[model samples]
Target: MNRLFDKSIVLACCIAAAVGLAVDARLVAAFCLGVIATSLAEVAQGNRARRASETASYVYIIAAVFVPPFVPLAPLAFYDIARRVRREHAWVALGIGSVFAFALIADLRTDALTARTLLLTAILSVAATLLSLRTAQLEREQQRMRRTRDELQERALALEARNRDLADRQDYEVELATLAERARIAREIHDNVGHQLTRASLQTEALRVVHANEPRIAADFADVKRTVDEALQLVRASVHALNDNAVDLSVQLDCIVEGARSDGGPQVELEALAEHAPANVANCFAAVLREALSNAMRHAHAKTITVRCMEHPSFYQLIVTDDGADATPASSSNVAEGMGLASMRERVEALGGTFTAGPRVGAGGWRVFATVPKPQGDEDR
Candidate 1:
């Protein structure tokens, strides 16, 4: 848009100079040619192109001196130069206008210079200078507006990036809090409900043993023990649901085995093959492993323990074996199991699994084996 407007101004100046030269002498026509060339040069160069174009406007002012009719074109050239130059160099345009005024005054061939002629020249020169200064002011205002727009765009981009980062951090904090809450609930169930049920099972088992001679009383005690075992299984399932299994099952098993070894217990080894399991399944397995290891280390006086995990087509299995004294003979007969074994059994069975713990039939050690069916849809994955 600016380019087209500049070209129009240059064309108008050329037409005016051509008409003026046609009515004047040949010498005046030749001088007007110089004015046309300088004006064209000023128009051809862009605002930010080079400093060489600035000199063309000064040359135009000199050309206008020899031809009075071309003086009107001087203000246009001055305005162009002012728009391009800095405010500190603004005096250059006014100085060129002053030179044009002096040349006009001196060019009068009359014996005496009239006040009317002098005043007219001064007014024309002052108008051209003021026009150029106004152009320079508008240019400065435009530059300031452009700078402000660029700054606002950059600030908007920075603010958008900051908002995205803040949103991501907020989501992370919420997830951490949720996981912490789930872990707390799991701990509460284990420490409270699990402990109370374990004690009840033990007492019920003791009552069964004391009433063994009375068949009816023993059967009633057995029924009570069965009810307690069922309640324990439900509590374990709830605990397993509350636990978040973000950690891999294999990593958790390794930590458990390492902890037993660090405590100066029997030499413990773990071999976990199943990499992915449902959260509830993994939690039940962890509980069973912890209880089995404790029983082997504390009651059986095992010298070494081996923990192995296997993945089947429809189920996952965990086996913990220890080179320890035989399991209590009563464990095979269902004649009142200990708290550790009973708790392990309940946890595994609660997840629709089978659990067995006793002395390995031809071996001199105890082995606890559990097999839980994979959740629907997880068996294939």
Candidate 2:
């Protein structure tokens, strides 16, 4: 659009100069030079060049003063000034253009000063000013539309980023809820199902003892007890899985031991002796073993930890010893009890067991020993 307007302006100027040359060659030469200079100034680079271009508009006004035929060309300079310069400057250019039009009227020959010539020049000047103002308004509107579009695009991108963040948060929240539900189920199984299984196993063992004299019935009772024990093991495994813990006690203990080793703690020696032990004893042993190893690594700073599971004639025992300075033997009265030690004691004593944890008598480390009594007359044979 701008290119077409420029071409039209150049063409009109050439035609006007040609008409002026037909009337007077000397005056047309000056008008053509002024037109060329103004055109070059319009395309010149920088603020100074643009101001110089605006100043060049006066050359057209000067030419109009000498030749009445050049009066029409005054509007072209006014239009350029209005389009390129500030409104205040454009108003000044209009004033100058109006003055040049009157000057052309004053310079006109007596025969040329007709109402038709004066009316035509007035109409053309008004049209040029109005056209320039409309073009400026349109340019401002286009710029505003471009700004609005950019703002909308930026807002859309921001909204997309926020939505992605919200989705990620929702996924994390769902995963957390799932894990919490699994933990709740595991706790329920441990408290209710686990207790019932332990009780059933004890009752079956009691029945086998009562019917010992009757060989056939005693064997059947023994098989029932073994089945109950297997069920207890299965329940324990289910609970561990639900809680996302190691399924087997031995495996769990080995993992803890390896973790300690990897952390540059103690060289742990573990022995799982009581393979066919009841579920309750095995679970208790696992808890105690974990606490012992934790104490050995954290408190004792032990170089070596020996973990053993011993099954006696009528009991299940676990011994965990660590070779560290804090494990040096102290009297019961002198030993300072911590929550870990206290919790282990409470858990063991709850099941008719003896729980002792302190420095070993001869060894330069700590020792944790727990002995849980089995049902009377019951043995893992």
Candidate 3:
């Protein structure tokens, strides 16, 4: 039964017992019948021991009925004893039966039988009390196990959440690393190979310009060929330096300006503030500066460009200012226009630095400023 039904049944049995006792009727017998019926129902509902022990319980009550003037009390004692026994306690049930039989055969007026019944009742009561204590202990253990299970379930859920969080963080870190590597490789390509190619293209254009009217003068063509060969050798040296992962930024900048001027790219001025600049830092800044200058000449139509490098205590700054025709003169586009600025931003920011490009206030074209940290050993390159 549900809790309410079980409670009501017990309450009804107690009330019946009280009324039967007041009216001098078979009160304990009625109570035993109720307990037996309920216990049997519990067993039929799959509570096995409840119904099985209840049979012995009912027999004990019938025996008690023939025995004493206070016979109802015998069933109450049997109900308590039945609640205590496991299947192996059949001997206890037989002992209860024998006590009830002896009580019935001996007369009530005999002092010996009265004393014996009293002693037997006391022993059964003690056994019931001990079994009740053991049941209480088992109940407490079950409660303890239930609480432990709840705690473990909570911890398991928390650990799962933590693992998910860690996994997400790792994925984000991986993506960031990939983007940084791309930026580094881009900077390498622009500052090294791109500069050399631009120089070669400039010399070829210059040779073509100088020999425009001397189509038949083969000696002047040979002189142009020698200059072309020297430029090629210098380009080769720069390429070699890149393979070794180091290059002189000053030399690279000279080559870039010379090539741009020769090809009529722009009138570009370059400067450096480092008494001892690191090769790696130089290479990165050179890449950024070259891209800026290329953007000014190709798109902005900048005429006079000044590229300045300034050294600070912890960081170095490269500033490229151009006096060029603005792409959007009416209401101009800012640094967000194309991949050139985007690439410059990515290169600087990935190295834990800042990049800002905008129109120079009032005077003319665009300004790009990139600040990069100088590592410890790079103070003198």
Best by lDDT: 1
**Per-residue alpha-carbon lDDT of model 3 for 52-119, expressed as tens digits?**
65565556456554634344344344544544456687686667766665665553456433445455
Worst 10 residues of 3 by lDDT: 328-337
TM-score against native, each model: 0.52, 0.52, 0.33
Over the full model, what C-alpha lDDT does candidate 3 score relative to the true structure? 0.60
The parts of candidate 3 lying over 4 Å away from their true place are: 1-29, 32-117, 213-381
Q: Candidate 1, residues 1-381: lDDT per residue as tens digits?
A: 443355465446434433423345643654465456445644565645446566666677777676565554555555556556666876776677677777667755541333443444455445544655665567678999998887786566445434543553465457557767988999998999899999999999999999999999999999999999999999899888778454477986788788778566688989999877765677678777876887788668998999998889899999999889986522232346754566667768878899998899888899999999987876677
Model 1, which residues run further than 4 Å from truth?
A: 1-21, 24-48, 67-70, 86-95, 110-125, 245-381
